[model samples]
Target: MEDDPDWGEMVSRHIGPHQKLRLHQVASVPEWAATADLSRYDLIFIDDSKTSELREQTIRHVLARVAPETVVVIHDFEIPPYQNAVPADFERIAFSSFRPMTGVVWRGARWTMPITQLAERIDARKHMSPLRHSAWRRYLASGTGPAR
Candidate 1:
């Protein structure tokens, strides 16, 4: 269950009495899904670091094991690779509802970028604006963008 040695140390340092943590790393979801008894767990945390195909496959595998009421938390759902990977059945919880102290620790220094900042930037971008319009115009005139 302890695939990452530092994870145990990190959890111990941060988590207090009320939390119970379990860690498991399987080479593939099918391996974990085949062996795990999901009835016992009220919650499951899935990390979507795998390819889109693999992530979708894992979700289906997990869904088969867990009960309807079982809560599933998926990580990296905001990143471009997995942004559209969320299943339609699962309700999207607002980021503000969960105050996470997440950061990137590089060379023993903590670097933080707020999710709000990223969201704001995305919101400000004009879809099919000047850049895209110009590109489309060039593509139509020269047929360069379209694959032959």
Candidate 2:
């Protein structure tokens, strides 16, 4: 999910062309937290950019709403402040020094599939991109499904 329209649009242009992506942009984190069906997502990226004034609150809301089995990729997790904000149960499932990002597993699961293969499946099946809305009702009603 992304809050910035410009970034969201860019993402649509890029990721949308190569892979299916349902981009959700919400005016407020609370609205998304209250309305989004977190169970639908297998992979979720929570952008913790420095400029998003709502960073901390947004992360908290995402964590609260995200399903236990979902994989959460927290952007900029290397940052001291952001690292401190993550919940204890979220195990660091993937991280690379070449990338300043981190992937977290919310719950333990018995899986034999390689992580890379699972990621590919999740990306291919992405749907439900909800654009930011001014009201809770609108937010609940928003989101674009992956193109057929």
| lDDT of the structure predicted as candidate 1 | 0.46
> How do the residues 39-115 of candidate 2 rate in per-residue lDDT, one tens digit apiece?
87777777734354456566667777787777777676666555665678665544433355565546565332455
Q: Per-residue alpha-carbon lDDT of model 1 for 21-98, expressed as tens digits? A: 655444566456646787777666665333656665555566666655565555544443333444555444423222
Clashing pairs in 2: 22-129, 24-130, 25-131, 25-132, 26-132, 129-143, 130-143
CA displacement after TM-score superposition, residue 89 of candidate 2 (Å)? 2.2
- In order of appearance, the predictions have TM-scores of 0.43, 0.61
Q: Report lDDT per candidate.
A: 0.46, 0.59
Q: Model 1 off-target regions past 4 Å?
A: 1-5, 16-19, 24-30, 48-56, 80-86, 94-148
